[model samples]
Each structure stands twice: as structure tokens, then as C-alpha cells.
Target chain A: MADRGKALALPVTLLLVFEIWARSAHLHSDSLAPPSAVLAALWSAFADGAILTATRDTLMSAFAGLFLGGSIGLALGILLGLLQPVDRLMEVTIEAIRPIPSIALLPIALIALGFGYRMEIAIVSFACIWPVLILARAAVREIEPRLMEVARALKLSPADRVRKIVIPAALPRIFVAFRLAAGIALIVAVTVEIAINPIGLGAAIMAAQQGLQADLMLAYLIWIGLIGFGLNAGLNLMQGRLFGRAALVRDRT
Target chain B: MTRPVIYWRIVSFVVAAAFVGLWQLIANLKLVSPVFLPGPDRAWASLVRGFTAGDLASKLLGTLEHMVYGWFLASVAGIALGALIGSSRTARSYVAPSLEFLRPLPVSAIIPVAIAMFGLTQTMALFVISFGAIWPMLLATIHGFAAVEPRLYEVARSLQMSRLAVIFKIALPSAAPDILAGMRLSLTVALILSVVCEILAGLDGLGHSVLLSARAFRSADLFAGVILLGVIGYLTSLMMSFAEARLLGYRRGVL
Candidate 1:
């Protein structure tokens, strides 16, 4: 724990330096608040429970989108993996669609669904599905062919084959996709809020900035950062618990 | 394609055509609102208008200029600082937590800070882009440097190579693959950040155009702007992959 504190010293020192600079540099304005002021802002927001409320909204939407997108992507990817005909039929469309960033879909969502929670969740899911689909497909493709031969020799039912073989093999890759998609889900959700919906930290930060509440804006950023860190760390811990650290797949493709 | 590949291509084409047909049918027949999902022809016409009748070319050029310069600056600084940290255990130990803390901050979250400091100018966009991009490249570079074989360092030391010589001659070449990988990640992120800043800040760019068209109820124009973004993203990735192949190929003495 002490060593860990040593590793964190640089960041703590940097924040201290920024605080000094903000107060004394003669360049400070409404846009740049000292650390003390930012802490006060954060404390006030926390004390009022505004921070918790916003965090809940952001977390709920992001998780809902991730679950929706991940399941569909996994199912589609397995279908594509098992059937060559289906894979070939969908390859061109999937390839074309996957490269487009999710943020690019914001306008279409805005027009179609309007500025609401539905549009935000739908676009977040859309942005998230591709990574899961692509990686899951690749993972299944990477499965050993001899195992299939053995399953065929055993005359196993297709459902049994999938249950026993495909999912187990694809679990690591699926975890990787989930990790990737988790990040995307947060990003897309926040962006949608910032651009159109105005429901979460994204909106709060933007509102604060526009209102020239620099301390509050900075406070919001710190919360956003903490949420992101917690999500990623939790996912990693889950992955490690399920599969052991050694078996984790780092590269998706 | 040969006969088998040709058959696959035909199947894929049919699937794609069916999707377009469905979209057009729903959009044109008013089963769905045209404001939501414009027909293919309408979107195409909007894209054509964007290119030929509007100033999309200039906005695209502006976005590209900001993205390229910002990403370049980030790459240079990230690699340099990463090399320094990775070369020394003490430096890495002190710096790693700071970097890890900053890494998880969403790129969109920082645009407000950029706006506060620089307003809605090109500089603001560039700052956001570079700031978001730096972490990936830095992390990757550090990994690359740490992965360098200790034997190589010993070999250089025995040969009386200077410290700078050791870094440039031995460390960098060995780390090139990972560094290139980092560059790819950073550049893709920079592209995202660049447009995002435009959208949030109301600066002149594709993202801005998309927002404007959507708000104006010009669904075709909105979809066109969205499609153009896909194209830009696709083309950049294509270019990056090609360059990566070339660089890796040269490293392998195959070019």
C-alpha cells in the first residue's frame, strides 16, 4: 500500500502544482478554478446528492445498452460463425458498417427518435454491437477445426455442440468485446447527453462550462473519470475471476 | 473472383440490395417517417449536394488539418516521454499511476475543459484531440520499450555504444511494431475527438453540418453528413493499415 502511494505521488503533485498555478499565475479567470474551489464544488454537489443522481442515470443507461448490444452481437456472431452461407451473405454489409464510428449515428438517432433516452440508448447499443460481433466472429473462427471433427464423430446435436464447445472457446474473446464495448457505451451515452439529451454528467459538465462554473465542470470531469475507472476495473476483475488472468485475450482481431 | 468466390459475392450483393430496398420502401412509402430514415436516393442526392453545392470540401479540409497536426504532435511527445519512462524503472513507477488515472477520463468529457481554456477555435479542437490521443500512444510505447530484450542492452554496452546510440539504434528499432500499433490507436481516437469537438463547440466541420441538418429537419442532408463521416473514417483506417503494412514489411526486409 505504501509503494502504491509512491506510484501515485506524481499525479497528486501535478494536481497540487495546478492548484498553485491557478491561484497565483495571474492568468486565472472564471474558466480556470483552483483545486480548493473545485473540491468545494464537488463536495457541495455530493452533499446535495446531485452527483449520485447523475451517476445513476449515466450508469443505468450505459449498462442497459451494453447488455442489449452484447447479447445480440454474440448471437449474431455465433450464427455467422457456424454457417458459411450466412457469413458470406452478411460479410460485405458487416464490413461496411463496422468501420463507422458510433458518434456518427447521433444525428440519425436525433432525427428518428428525437432527443430522448430511447435515442441515446439505441445509438449506444448500435455503437457497441460491432466490436462484440466482429470479435466474437473472429474468436469462433479461431476455434480449432479438429474439435468440430470430434464432435461430428460423436454425432452430437448442434445445440449440444454449441453449448459445449463454441461458447466456452469464445468466452475470452467475448469478455474482451464486453470490455471494449463497455468503454464505447459510456462514451456514446455521455456524447448523446452532451449533444442532445442533457441527462447525465455530459450535460452537467457542458452546462457548467457554459454557465462559467469552471470548478463545477472540473468536478464533473473527475466524477466521470472515476466512473470510467471503476467500470473498467470491475470488468477486468470479473474477467480474471472467470477465466484466470493467464487465459485472457488481449488482442481482439 | 473465381467461380466459388463469385457466387459468394453475388449472395452478399443480394443481401445488401435487399437492405437498401427495404430502406427505400419504408422511407418512400411513409411506413416510417422520412425524417427518421430517408430513402437511399434522397441521401445520395444530399451527399452530392454536400460536395458540389455546399462548402463540405472546406470543412472536411479543416477537420483533416486539425486532426493530422494534433495527432502528429501527440505521437512525437508520447513516444519521447514513453521512451524516457520505460528506460528507467524509477520513472515508470512514479509516472504510471498518474497516467492510469488520466487514461480513463472519457474524451468527450474533456471538451468542456478545452472550451473553457481555448473557446471554440481550431486550437480548442486540437488541444482536445491531442490530449485524448496521447494516453494510448504513451502506454503502448512504454510497453514496447519494456519488452526490449535485456541481451540487446548488454550487447550495446559491451560494444561501447553511447546512451543515445543505445536508444536510437537498439531500443527504437526493436519497439517499432508496438509504437506503430500505438500510433494507429491514437490516430483513430484523434479523428473521433476532432469531430466531437466540432459538434460540441459548433465549429465548422462535418459534425457541425450533421447537427445543423438534423435541427433544420433536412434528414437527407443529415444522413449525408453521417455517411461522409463513415467514409472519412473508412479511408483513414485504410490508409493507416496500408502504411502499417509497409512499415512492418520494411522492418521485415520484404519491402
Candidate 2:
């Protein structure tokens, strides 16, 4: 309880100071908003369903991109991990491509796919793929040699070996990869919206900024942060439930 | 093992060649519009032409300048604050909760706030970039300093070493690896935020150039800008790894 009080002291004091200053100064600036005003803005936005709608749009695109990218990365990572020759052949190519920031692909994607969900998903997918691919490949490669020996001893076919042995062994790490990819997907999706696409929470922030609605803009920013925090917390909970202490241990690095 | 290593190199070379060959073939065949999907040769040509005749070099330099500046600021600030928090049990307990709350907030979300406060200016970009890039380094520094061997502090106390001296001599070197790792991550974050800022603010950088070319439907120029950014990213990471190896040289083979 004392620790909890210590944690809240700084933020609470800071917010109270800001609230008093804003109220006393009557600083109706275009950029700065008081805590109380921000709270009020958040409340109204929620009542009007604006925040909910923007969140839905953002989540839809983010999840779509994550699913598409995660699957492709999983397949490619598994193949590369399982096949020594293929992994060797692909090393240089993957390295060459991986350094290119996904945001840099915005221009190409925009020109090719035009504005809207398709373009945003393409960029998010591009961003999400690398983490999964790299992590999954590492996880697969790190599997115990004895496991492969067991598969061979059982005379398991190649397909069965992968299905029964490789996947199960690697699933936990791969799930961690997906969690990382999920974060990337949301970030890239918001970035796409902020940069060009006019949908979702990022677009809302941009719109509010342009309108000089500081309270609204802050509200949206806070909302997005909350969404991100919630997503991470939920994933952590799921990972804990699924993999127990093992997932938490792997996550630190 | 050596034979397989040579074979792997050869296979990699062949695969790369095939990829370029296929790309050129597709471009020549006009399977996709040249406007949208230009050949690799065209991209190479445009890259060369942009450097020689166009203002691409200046834009590239501007981006590098912005990225380095922001990254430098983040490193200094993150290290200082991290040390202060990490060295004190009271400060760490109070500050850590706020950091935990803030860390997961996507850096991109802060862009709008920065823009609102500072408008479309280099100062805004620098602020946004530093703010975005600071977290990894700060966390790493805190972890590093806090995890410093208790015996080291005991020795410092025995010698009557000053607090600042103890930190500079003992904490900094001990924390170098974690700090370096965080710096590497922050550099990437700096680059990404710099690009995002340039694109949004119409700054004179490769990002703005790419955005402009795309808007004008100049696919080749856009691709060239992208390729250049990729090279920059690759080179920076390469340099960082070298720096890491050099800085941590004393620990070589010990781990």
C-alpha cells in the first residue's frame, strides 16, 4: 500500500498542479489543455461514440494486417528453419530487405494501392513480418537435437515430424513473436493513418490538431495510449495463461 | 563444415542473381505498369541520377543530421535521468511506475501532440524524435545501474569515493553493454521518427522527397529514395555493431 501511494504521488501532484495553473491562468491556448478539460473532452468523446468508432477502425486494420503478416512469417520462418539449404540461400536476400523501414515503403504502397485500408494493411504487414520471422526461425533452430532424434527414431514422415514436433516445440516462442508483431502492427497502422490515410485514431488526432481542439487531441492521444496499454496487458495475461512462467521469462530479453 | 560454408555462399549468390533476373524480366515484360513497378535497373539509375543531378543528396544529409542530433539528445538525457533514478532507491520507486505506464504508449501517438505544441519545425521533429527514442535507453540504463554489483559500491564506499565519481567510473562501464544495446534501438527509433516527421512536416529530407514523388506519381524517384534509406539503415546498424564490439572489447571471451 505504501508502494502504491509512492507510485501515484508524482502523477497526482503533477496533474493537480496543471489543473490549478490552467484554471487560475485561464490560458485558453490552442495547444495546451487542462487536465479537467481533457477529462471532460474524453467523456464527451466517449458519449458520442467517436472514440469507439475510431478504435474499431484502427483495430480492424491492425488485426487484419497482423493475421496476414503473422501467417506468412510463420510459414516462411518454419521453412527456413527446417531447410538448411533454403535458409542459407535466403540469408543475404532477407538481410538486404529487412533494413528498409516499413514507413519508407509508404510511398510505393500508396502509389500501388491508393489510399484506405489496403494501403495501411500493406505497410503494417510489412512492419509486422520481420519480428515473427526472425523470432520463429530462432525458436525453431534452438529446438533440442534429441527431439529431432526422437522423430527420426519413430520413423515419422517429414510432414508429421514438423506437425507433431517442430510446431509444438516452437509455438510458445512463436506466440511471443506474434505479441511483438501485434505491437508493431498497431504502431505501423497508426503511423500510416497519421502520415497519409484519413481513418482511425491517428487521423482523429490529426483532425483535432488541425481544428485546434487541444482537449480533443489530448483525449485521442490518451485513448490511443490506453488502447496500446490494454492490448499489451491483455496479451501478457494470455501469454501467462498459455505458457505460464516460461513466457514471462522469455519476454524480458 | 568449411565445404558447406562455401556451398552456402554459392547458393546465396545464385539466389540473389535469380531474384534480380526475375525482377528485370518482369519489368521488361511490362507485367505491371512501369509507373507503379519500375525495374531494379531503373531504380539504380534513378538513384544515381538523384545523387548526381537532383537535390537528393542534400535531403539525405538533412535526414542524417536530424537523426544524429535527436539520437544524441536522447542518449544524453536518457543516461542522465536513468542514472539519477537508478542510483536512488526512493527515486526509482517513485519514478518507475510512471515510466511503466508511459513506455508502452506508442511513440507515434505523441507526434500529434508535438506538432500541436511546436508546429512544423525542426525543433518539433527533434523534440518528437528524442521523446520517442529516449525510452529504450532510459530503461536499459536504469536496469544497468541498478544491477551494478553490490561489491563495487562497497569498494567505492571503502575508498571514500564521491557519488559522482563512483557513477562515472563504476556504473557507466558496468552499464555500457545495456546502454549500447538501448542506444542501437534508439537510433532506429530516431531514424523512423525523423522520417515520419519529415513526411508530415514537409521537411527537406528523403522522407519528404519520397512523399512528394509518390504524390506526383514518380515511382522511380520514390523507389530510389527508399533504397537509399534502406542503405542508410543498414550502414548505421553495421556501424553500431562495430561500436558495440569495440566498446565491450575488454569483456571479449569472458562472457
Candidate 3:
């Protein structure tokens, strides 16, 4: 009975119903193309090199921003976490600025950098940095002082202590922050590209929408979704493989 | 070192001031075109003018309305669903995977579908914002409820408390922190999504105004809109934090 009930679950049922609706309603190609038509459109878009260039451009900008922003955020977070004066000095200002959505910086970025990859990259980096910085700082602050004391007792240098005690202790949370930041980076990247009308997947989707090619737009949307899902899934898998035991240990403590 | 810390604060202030002051200097120097990057003074003047002329207010109100409506609906729905799922392990097993799948999908990716389904209207904007806002609330609620002590549940069950009563009396109080954190996240996402939807869909809001100013090369007005968005976002977060502190005062007793 339990198996039967589980087999008739909500998502599967919804999917089946949606498929039937798609078949029956005959959704319009220009505005509301069916999923089947969207899949075909996706194939055609991929075959034509439209998907390739756009995907590459989008990924490149996102990756560049992610690396730049994540590294800076991690370094700063650790620095502030270690230094009480720095944390105290920066706390209020960071709090004030942090709430301002990175999208709000679009106009300034555009004015300073112009409407291209540079502007998109700046926006993505700004958006991705804050959450990661916050998480990393918190993770650092949460590190047990006893570990640091033990390292000091052993006459370990600052660098060695950081490497052996701080990094390993903070690594799990940092990775979690990275996972969160990756999702945010991708989202901001796509949105910035779309808003800026750059030559990327976002641009393609906007173009298709403007041209009233719903099928093509839907295809682009699906591709972006798949990319986001793939990244997130990959991160989740990595977390399970690397830090799964650490997470359990932390929980127990 | 203490002086350097003070100096660093001063330097940060100077850095921010110099950024604006340099803009004024550059504008005066005509190092580049004023059409692209207007001075701070001009931007402030334009902001005042735009507000006095009621251009800024209307657009701000439009965005605010959508954000409030969308965020309200998302929170209510998210809390309800999260509670339902949190109450039962079977429900969690069934829904958690699907929620996880959907949670990571960029909200922007769904805008095209939303626009297709709802058209380029307030509904589309609301739909997009709500979709983005819901995840944080849902996840927070799940975390909050899951964090509830098992002993409390056992006590409730032994007392033969009604399920609803148990949830209200035991589950909710335990989960309040997680729920508040979730709401804070949702609030930020809602604001971001509201602005993005307005910009991309060409809807009537501060985002659209920013895009309009940019296209017209009205750099001051563009900056003004950005400033307004920043102010609104900052205020919203402040308000949320204050509310959380006030409402969760009881939790300090437990700790």
C-alpha cells in the first residue's frame, strides 16, 4: 500500500497531467510552445552553434566572476574573522551595504564599465561576494579556540596553525558557502546578461522573447535551468563525498 | 595598530568620499563625457528633481506594491507547505528531493515561462518574485521545525494534545529562528526579483525607470534609481532584523 501510494506521487502525477495538457491544448509555437516543441527547438538551437557560443560566453563570465569574487570574499572574511579590530571597524558598513542587492549596482557598473562582459562580470562578482563573505566570517568566528591554543602550545607558527587548525575547521562551512555562492553567481550572471542585453544565453532568450519565438526562449530557459541544476548537483555530490563525515562529526559535537 | 584601525575607518570613508569627489572632479575636468558619468551633485539634483516631479515616487510605489503582495503570498504559502512537510517524515521524503531540485534553478530562467504563461503584466512580475522568495522561506521553515527537540514532541503526544495545538505550541516556537532567517532571505530575494522582473519584462517600476534613464543617457536619474533601490533594500533588512529581535525575545530565556 505504501509503495502504491508512493508510486502515485505529486510530481509524477503533475508531469503526466502536464504532458496530457500539452498534447491536448496544442500550445502556440510563438508564445506558449509545448514541452515537446521546446525540446526540439533546444536541439535545433544547439545544432546551429547558437547554444554553444551563448553558453560559452555566459559560463566564461560567470566562472571569472565566481573565481574573482569568491577568492576575495574568502580572504577578507578570514582576515576580518581573525582580527577583532578589522571586524569591529567594518561590521556596520558591511551590514549597511550588504542588504543592497547587487542588481542595484547595475547602473553604476554600466556607467563605469559600459554594456558588455565587463559590466556583467562586475555585477556577478558583486552579487556573489557578500553571502560568501558573511558565511566565511561566521564559520571562522565559530572555530573552537582550544584548537588554536593547542597549536600555540606546540609552538606552531601562525601560518602552520592556520593551515592545520583554521583551514580544516573552516573548510566545511566555506564549501557550503561556495555552493550557495555558485548558485547566486549563476543567477546574477544570467540576469545581468539578460538585463544588459549581452551576447549570451540571456541575450538569446531576450531576443527570442522579443521576436515572439516562445519555443526558442523556452529552450534557452531549459538550458539555463539544466546548467544551474547541474552545478548545484555537482556541488552537492562533492559535499557528500568530501565533507559528509565532517558534517556528521560536527553535528555530534 | 589602534590608530591604524581608526585610520582604516577614516580611509574607508575617504575612499567612498573620494569616489564621489573624483566623479565631481572628472565631470569638471571633462576627462570623459558627462553623458556617461554625471557628477555626484548633478545626480543628487536630478534625484531631487525627479522625486519632486513625482516620477520617482510612482515607479517606487509600483515596485513596492508588487514586492509586498508577492512576498506576502510567498511567505504564507511557504510557511504552510513547510509546516506540512515538517510534521511528517513521509512527506519530507517525498517533497524534499523535488524542492531541492527546484530550489537551485535560477529564478531568471523561469521568467520566460512566467511571461509566456502570465504575459508581461503585474502577474508575471509577482509570479517571478514569489517563485524566488518561496524557497528560502520553505527551507528555513523545514530547518526550524526539524530543529525542534524530540522531547517536546513526546510531551505533547503524551498529553494528548491536538496535532494543531502541538504544532502551534511546540513546533512553531522551536522553529522561529530558522523561520525568521528564512524570511530575511526571502525579503532580499523578493526585492531583487521584483527589480529584475521589472527591468527585463519592461514593467513599470524603479527598475524600468533605471533602464529608461540608461537608454536615454540620463546618467544622474539612473544613479538616482539605483540609490533608491539601495535605500529601500537597506531599510527592509533593518526592519526585518528589528522585528526578529523583538519577536524572538522569548528565545533568550531558553538559552
Candidate 4:
């Protein structure tokens, strides 16, 4: 933990330098805010509890979308993984769809579903699905041939094989996908809000920017970072609990 | 491929065609509001019209230029800083907190910050894209270089190779796999951030055109714009994989 302090020292020093520079330089512009002022802005915003509300709104869309997209991805991945024909038939389409950044769909989604929760959640879901689908498919395809032989010898039905063999083997990758998706979902949700939906932390950030509240905008940015950190940390903890630390490791090789 | 697999591949094409046909049918029949869901024909016409008017081409060029520049800057910075931090544990220890604090922040959260600094200009889009693209590559490079086998280092040292020689000949080759993966991810992020900043900055780009089309009730044009972005995204991704394949030919292909 003391080493952690060493880790933070550099950043703290940089911020302090920035604070001194901003004040000494007397840059009374909207472009720059001293670290102290930014902190004060963060404190005031937190005191009013507005940041929490905006945070809840953002998390709601992200989680709701994550659930919808994650499940669809899992189901599709399983289907394709177990059935060679299905995999062959869908590979091209999936590949083509995979590259489309969900953020770009904001305009179309806004037109189709209108502003607010529906449109925001839909775009978020689209963004979340791709990583999950790609990872899940790879996981399934990597199942050991020996495991399949054993299942075959045991005369296990396809459903049983999938349930007992495929899912367990793929759980680690799926969880990784969930992590990636969660991050993407949060980003997309916030983007939708900032760009078109006009609700949540993103909307708050935009409002602050337009109001020319540089300090307040910096504060909102901090809160957004905290929320993202919390989500990632929570997921990491859950994955470790469910699947062991090995599963949470970024690179197996 | 076997006969059934070949048949399945053909089936994929058929399925795609069928979906488009169904979309056209519903669109023309007014089963859904055209304002919400423009017909494929309308979308196609919009594509042609935008190109003929040179509106879409210019926007695309603007977007591509911004993304390419931002992505290039990100690659250079990410790899350079990554190599620095990865080169030593002491460097990593000092830098870890900064990287941690910055990496967790969602890219959207930084849009406002970029706006405050750059304010609705092409630079704002570039700044945000570069910022967003850097982290993944940075993290991966650090991990890759740090994870280089200790024995490899020992051998290089025993052979009296210079620091630069060790890094180039030994450390880099082993780190290539992870660095390549990071590059792919960063490219995708660069593309996404470019579009996003275009929208937020209300700048001249495909994203801006899409937003404009929606606001003006140009549904067909909006769809066309989205499809154009999608096509661009797909081709870039394809290009990345092709490059990855050639770079990692020893492994036959990228993961």
C-alpha cells in the first residue's frame, strides 16, 4: 500500500504543478481551471447530490442495455458454436455488423425510437453485443476435443453437452466479454445522452459545458470516471468470486 | 470446404438478401412510418444524391482525415510511452497511478473537457480521439514488454547487447502479439471517437451530417449516413486484420 503512495505521487505532483501554473499564469479563461477550483466544484456538486442522480440515470441505461445485449450475444454465440452450419451461415453477416460503431447509429436510433431511455438503451445494447459475441464464439470454438470425446462416449445429448461442457468452458471468456461490454455500454449510454438523449451524467456534462462552467464540467468528468471505475471494480470482484482470480487475469498466455 | 458448408455459405448470402427484400417490402408498403424507417430504395437514392452533390464525400474525407491524424498520433505516443514504462519496473511504479486514473474514465466523459479546451473545432475531435485511442495500446504495450521472459533478457545481457539492441531484437519480437492486438483495438476506438466528436462538436463529418439529417427529418439521408459510417468501419477493421495476418504470419493469423 505504501508503494501505492509512490504510484500516486507523480500524478499529485503534476496536479500541484498545474494548480500553481494556472494561478500564477493568471489565466482567467474558460479553457483552464486550477485543481483546487475543480475540487471545490466537485465538492459542491456532490453536496447538492445532483451528481448522484445523473449517475443513477447513466447506470440505469448501461445496465439495462448490458443485460439485453449480453444475453443475446450469449445465445447467438452458443448457437453458432455448437452448430457448424449455423456458424458458416452467419459468419459474414456477423463480421459485417461487428465493425459498425454503435455511436454512429445514434442519429438513426433517435429518429426511429425518439429521444430518452429507449433510444439510449438500444444504442448501448448494440455496442455491448459485439465484444460479447466475438469473445463467446472464440471461447466455444476453443473447447477441448478431449472434452467432446468424453461427452460423446457418455452419450450426452446436445443440450446436456452445451450445458455441462460448453458453458463452463466458455464462462471465463463470457465474463471478459461482459467487462468489455459493460465499459462499452457505459460509454455508448453516455454518448447517446450527451448527443441526443439529453438525460443523465452525459447531459449534465453537456449542460455544464454549454453553461461555460469549466470547473463544474471538470467535476462532472471526475464523477463519470468514478462511476466507470466502480462498475469495472465491481465486475472484477464478481468475476473473481465466481470464476477465480485466473479468470480475471487479462492475458492467460 | 465440404458440400454442406459450401451450401451454408450460400445460405448466408440468401439470408442477407431475404432480409433486405423484406425491409424493402415493409418500407414501400408503409407498414412503418417512413420518417422512422426509410425504405431501402429511399436510402439508396439518398446515398446517390449525397455523393452526386459531393456533400457526403467531403464529410467523409474530413472525418477520415481527422481519424487518421488522431490515430497516428495515438499510435506513436502509446507505443513510445508504453515502451518507456515497460522498459523498467521503477518507471511503471511511478506511472501506474496516472494511467489508472485516466484509463477508467469513459471517453464520453472527456468530450466536455475537450470542448472546453478546443471548443467545437477539428482539433477537439482529434484531441478526444487520440486521448481515447491511447490507453488500450499503452496498457497492452506495457504488459507485453514487461512480460518478456527474464531469461531472454539474461541471454541478451550475457551476449553484451546494447540496451537499444536488446529492445529491438529481443523485447520487440516477443511483444509484437500484444502490441498488435492493442493497435487493432485502438484503431476501432479512434474511429468511434472521431464520429462521436463530430456529433458533439457539430463539426463537418459523417456524424454531423447524420445528426443534421435527423433534425431536418431527412430520414433516408440519415440512414444512408449511418450505412456509410458502417461501411467505413467495416473496411478499416478488414484492413487491420489483413495487416495483422501479414505481421503475424508465423502464427498463421491473428486471434
Residue pairs clashing, model 2 = none
Q: How many clashes in each candidate?
A: 0, 0, 0, 0
Candidate 3 lDDT by residue in tens digits, B166-199: 7789988888888888898888888888888888
lDDT of model 2 at position B74: 97
Q: Which ten residues in a row have the lowest lDDT in candidate 3 chain B?
A: B11-20
Between which residue pairs do clashes occur in model 3? none
- lDDT per prediction? 0.83, 0.91, 0.82, 0.84
Q: Model 2: per-residue lDDT, tens digit, A117-188?
A: 999999888888889898888888888999999999999998899899999998889889999899889988
Candidate numbers sorted by TM-score from highest down: 2, 1, 4, 3
**Alpha-carbon runs more than 4 Å astray in model 4:** A23-27, A142-169, A245-253, B1-7, B251-255
In candidate 2 the C-alpha lDDT for residue B145 amounts to 93
Give the per-residue lDDT of model 1 (tens digit) for A1-253: 9679888788789789988887788545757788888899999999999888888888788888899988889889888988878999997788677777787788787777777678888888887888888888888887889988888999889898888988887788778888889988998888778766778788888899999998999899888998888888898788788778534655534
- How well is each residue in B1-255 modelled by candidate 1, as lDDT tens digits? 699999898889889889888988888799987767789999998788778998878878867777788899899989999989987778877887778767877877888888888988888888888888888889887877788999999999899998789889988888888888888888778877777877877877888888888889898888887777788778888888898888778666743
Q: Is candidate 1 or candidate 4 better by DockQ?
A: 1
Choose 1 or 2, whichever is better by lDDT.
Answer: 2
Identify the superior model by lDDT, candidate 2 or candidate 4.
2
Q: What DockQ would candidate 3 receive versus the native complex?
A: 0.39
**lDDT at A3, model 4:** 90
